[model samples]
Target: PALHRQRHQFVIDFVKQHKPKKVVDLGCSECSLLKKLRFHREIELLVGLDVNGAKVKKHMYGLAPISTDYLQPTYDQLCIELYQGSVTQEDARLRGFDLVTAIELIEHLTLADVGLFSAVLFGYMTPVAVIVSTPNSEFNPLLPGLRGFRHSDHKFEWTRAEFRSWALKVCLDYGYEVAFTGVGQAPQGQQESVGFCSQIGVFHRIGGRNGCNMLLDDDADDVFSYTLLYSIKY
Candidate 1:
């Protein structure tokens, strides 16, 4: 309930914040964000994907038209487009959108697929923004007996430092500029799992710094946050 409500709010707020022409929500479970985006009068398109078809069906009552193994467009912006697929392995064919989002994704994929996954994702961008998130490695409950952090399906999580280092490389390798980065929210009094990252990244495409690999700008914000980074990279 809280997750869906928050997702709805996030979509509403994000649409207002960026006013993107097109948006993609990778690893979108049940299209919560996409469904919430329905009220955005300015949104021209919304696409969502999930690795599991059952989850997609559970979330989307009418998305049965998308019968392909991966994706088949279901609707225009006014009618949320949902797909059953994997962000890590599925083709990131969404090209040149004003925004692309991967909420609670990344850590679910094998570490080996991280780079290729990102590369595929970055390939379709038309010099715009990307919003991505994953679990923090410091607090993942995957340890035995739930001693610390644990997740049933997580492949790998990254610490703040680890996330930053990878983020820096992602910017350089993919021609994006970092604008902001931070952690996601946690319940009051309950320490949030940093080891189980709930990170967010916002990026935009740009040229390298005089022919060298483009590094995250020093001005990039690693400011105060709670379960979401709101990082803006170009």
Candidate 2:
């Protein structure tokens, strides 16, 4: 879970740096990052989207709530909206957020679906900034006893080179500038060469048509049903 902690901190730092007023988190299972962002009063609107309605329902209704120990008494005071939906589909509800994030999420999607998801995220939703993180396939070999992919659900993992190639293409197509970084440590000698255990890409829209007006050109079907889990406004 060290990798997750690293990613969480990395994103938290990103939020601090940008000080976005509105933010959306893709693949926001259990709203872990949302809980962390609650401490920052600058963020006035927080929305979380996930494909799993059941899980969102559980979290919102307290059947499987996120921890509140790090939360202030008024933490629940801010109404965090939750949506059950796929990131690869067009939704009028997701527009105008200043920031969007997908932490360790892309690998769970098929390569073709990855393209669709990209189109939806960059092409349509068109947030001012987007952050994505995924497993660095090249680093898998360095971990003791770990084999194959890092997780059973990952459809395909990408090496650092592969990830950069794809990320560059997305930026070029979407008129965004992107920067790459990593999470977790590499072996002492391999630190500079092999990079980190997780790869991250942050995209900033410079100029281009807002993707909401552009159609998602990929063929992958939208598998998730959009359901309102909860909408609380403080």
Q: Estimated TM-score per prediction? A: 0.68, 0.85
Q: Candidate 1 residues 1-234, lDDT tens each?
A: 454355346546767987876777877776667656644646666667676767766766543323341242453334356666555543333445677877777877887788867776764333377776666655444333654334667776677777778778988776777654444344554444443225556676674223223232433532221122111111
The per-model lDDT (C-alpha) reads 0.58, 0.80
| Candidate 2 segments exceeding 4 Å error | 61-77, 207-225
Question: Considering every candidate listed, which one attains the maximal TM-score?
Answer: 2
Error of 1 at 41 (Å): 2.1
**Model 2 deviation from the true structure expressed as Cα RMSD, one decimal place:** 5.1
User: Which 10-residue span in candidate 2 carries the lowest summed lDDT?
Assistant: 61-70
